[model samples]
Each structure stands twice: as C-alpha cells, then as structure tokens.
Target: MPRSRMLEYDGAAWHEDCFLCSGCRKPIGSEAFVPDNRRFYCLACYEQQVAPRCSHCRKALTKGGLTYRGEVWHRDCFLCCGCGSALAGQTFTSQGERPYCVRCFSSLYAKKCAACNTPITGFGDGKYVSFEERQWHQPCFKCSRCSVSLIGSGFFPDRDQILCADCNSDD
Candidate 1:
C-alpha cells in the first residue's frame, strides 16, 4: 500500500484501495474490469450477469437493440402478434401486451358499414352516420326510391326501407 509499491496501469498509478472488483470482491490488477451502473464487474460477471438481454429471445443482445414500451428486443426478434411479421422500424398497434401490424389490426377491429357492406374507417372524408343504432356511410344513406339523401331531413320508414317525406307522401 506504499507509494513506492504502487502499480502503474494505463500510465497511471493505482492504489490498493481500488484493487477489488465489485462483483466477486477479488483483486483486479491488470485484468480488465467492465464498468456498469457506476460499479465495476469482472470479465466473467460482466458477460454472465451484467450484460443486457433481449426480452423476446431471452439471449444476450450483442449488438444494438430496441426498447419499446419498456421491453427490450433484438431486431430479428421483434415481430407482430397477428401475422408474425417483423415490426422493426415499422408502425405497430398493441392489444394488451401483444404487438400487431396496422393492416392486421384494422381487419380485426375495424367497424363495417351497414349500408355499403364495406369497412367504415373514418379516414379522410369518409364519415359515418348512425341512425336507429345502425351505421351507414355518408354517401350511402339515401331513400330507397328516387335515391335522395335523407340526412338531417324528414324521412319515413316503409316496410324494410327508408323513404323521403316527398316520396312517402307520393306513394
């Protein structure tokens, strides 16, 4: 522990006070000690216990990995829940803790239009009209006869169809 007995490493003299490794409490003289979280670990402990691991593969992430929703995943291990497609660098949706692609998510959860028999996704100018607990597209809502728009206007229900006030009176 004397200055005359100090060991020189990397052009600097290291004393006995800093000679012990944090993991095994063993003397680390010239051996490399990896620093992690402000604590130094021996080579064996660093590779076995202190290294970061992927959540999906459960293996040590040797290269760069991604952290999504607080879960770590390697590039090849990040996949969609619905189609099992790769989700790396792609937009995804989550159901509970499972990740799914946009196309798969829409097909599974999108609402369909009752009048047009097509999915009524409210994207852009596609608007939905709800009447009598039934959903219809804006362009599809019309009277059965003469095909007149009945939105925000007086209309009558005839049998299994909707009719405009003028058409209902005429009939």
Candidate 2:
C-alpha cells in the first residue's frame, strides 16, 4: 500500500505542520495563534494544553505564581531558619521572621547548672541554689523528695549555688 500525507477533515484536505492543530493534530483554518508562539490548535485542544497545576496544593499556578523546590507549596509552608523545622502552631519571636521550634529556641537561652554543669531544666530568678552538695538553677535545685530551691538567698560552707559571671549574663 501507499502512505497518506493528506489529512482529511470534514471533506477538506490540509498540509502537514501548516494548518493542523498543535494539540489534537486536527486541521484548523485561520485560528488565532497564541502570544509569542504561532502554534495553531482547536479551541478545545488549546484549553487542554494550558499550564499545569501545583503538585503540593493541586492548585493551578498561573504565570507569575511561585514554585518552591520544584514543587508548588504555598508561601506559608516554609521551614524555620533556626532549626530548619517546619513552622506551625508557634509564635514567632521576630515580627517578620519565621519562628524557631521549641527545642531550638529553648537551647538558645538555656544555661548550664553551676554544680552539675548540665543544662538548666526550669525557670529561676536568674540565680543558682544549693542542693545535695551541688549547685543548680534556683528552679532546678531540689531536695531529695521536695525538689525545691531554698528560699533564703545566702551561701553556706560546702553548700552554695554560685554560677560563673560569664554564664550569668549570656544571652
């Protein structure tokens, strides 16, 4: 048999790549060309070849829309700069900046116990207290059963909670 180069449409013949629809490959006559590109296509096929939707939100991202990390996530889905964790359900310290996670923010201001030299676990009046022959933050110091810092603020022999000056004023 012989090959057919003639595209038949509604009893009319058209040339290849000349008046054929770019999408459905059907014959088109004097259709409007899209801006910047002269490709011709039927109205139905033109709509079908429109821009794709976002992968993350499944929303149509038209021209001038943003695409992040090759996926289309909303601007609010970005992570925190301090810990690089996703930001959600937390108050930001900086008005215009993304907030750090609890873990990251706590580590930023937490201080080491004077006696044990471990990170303080609770709030205090910015002072250290003696407990079991060791010094700890006022709130973190505790009795064996009561686990509370002494009320009177003074030092005792071999019993004191004094932190180094360098560790006291750190931010």
Candidate 3:
C-alpha cells in the first residue's frame, strides 16, 4: 500500500478546509488550482468563467488576450474600427480608443481639399495629391491660375492657390 504524502507549506501541513474554488464553489479535491487575488480557482473554472474577455468579441480568452488602454482583444478579434478588417501585422491608426486601417483612417479623418472644399476620402481606388498639406482629387489637381490640368508636371502653392511653375514665373 502507498503511504499518503503530506502537503506542507511554510512550517505546517496545508489544510484541506481552504481548498474550494471561488467560481464554482466546489472543493478543489486533488485537481489543479490557481490563486486569484485572495481567492482560489480550479483550472476548469478559471478557464471557463474567470478569464478576461475580448473587448471586440466579448468572449473569454483562455490563455492570453491583447491588452490596450485597459481593454482586451483576441488575436482574431482585433479588427479595424472603421471597415472591420483585420489589423494584425498591418499599418493601422487609433482614434477615440478605436483602431483603424490606414485607408479607413485617411478617408474618415483626413482634411478636405483647399480648392473644392470636399473631404478627400481616399477610399477604394481613389487617389489624392497633396501640396503644402492641401489635398485634391487626381483629376481636380489643376493649376489655380490657368485652370489647366497638372497631372504630371510640377506645380507650386502660392498662398491658397496652386500654380504651375510657368504660371508662378509669370506672376
């Protein structure tokens, strides 16, 4: 017959009266357990009910969760706040405690065109050109003085207007 092994702690044998799981209110028996603050949790109870939840999906994370600004997220639940796309291993931005993909961030938050006074939402395949922080649609990018398209040629910003190098020299 095998002799029962005494579980010792500090200088005394560990008492069995304190071996209950806080979550399930069940005796821990000989099962594995962990300490949470001043309470003890059985392995199953901790994994099922005591773990932190993902902020995006609201599901409990068994092993680990990504923590940001006091919020938690699962690896697959960390999505762009604007378009709901995955942001892992991709360039992203944050606003008001929400993460966003680069395109969604630029489209939803970037400044408007100085000339047209419309939002430069660079969504989908749309493109934008900037001169001195002023943004314009590719087709709308024209010389302010001559109203000529400056798709490829160089242009300069004079105060609130963009002028071709030729127009700037004429001024």
For residues 55-130, write the lDDT of model 2, one tens digit per residue. Answer: 5455544444444445554444445567776554444332233345545654674456754566553433546654
The clash numbers for all candidates, in the given order, read 0, 0, 0
Q: What Cα-based lDDT does every candidate model obtain?
A: 0.76, 0.50, 0.77
> What is the C-alpha lDDT profile of model 1 across 1-171, one tens digit per residue?
556345555566657566667778887766877767656677887767877788988887656889888978998899998889999998777777888777776677656666667765555456877767566788887988989997888888776678898899997
Give me the overall lDDT of model 3.
0.77
**Clashing pairs for predicted structure model 3, backbone only:** none
User: Residue 152 of candidate 1: its Cα lDDT?
Assistant: 82
Of the candidates shown, which would achieve the greatest lDDT relative to the real structure? 3
Instruction: Write down the TM-score of every candidate.
Output: 0.55, 0.30, 0.56
What is the alpha-carbon lDDT of model 2 when measured against the actual structure?
0.50
Q: What's the C-alpha lDDT at position 11 in model 1?
A: 61
Error of 3 at 37 (Å): 1.4
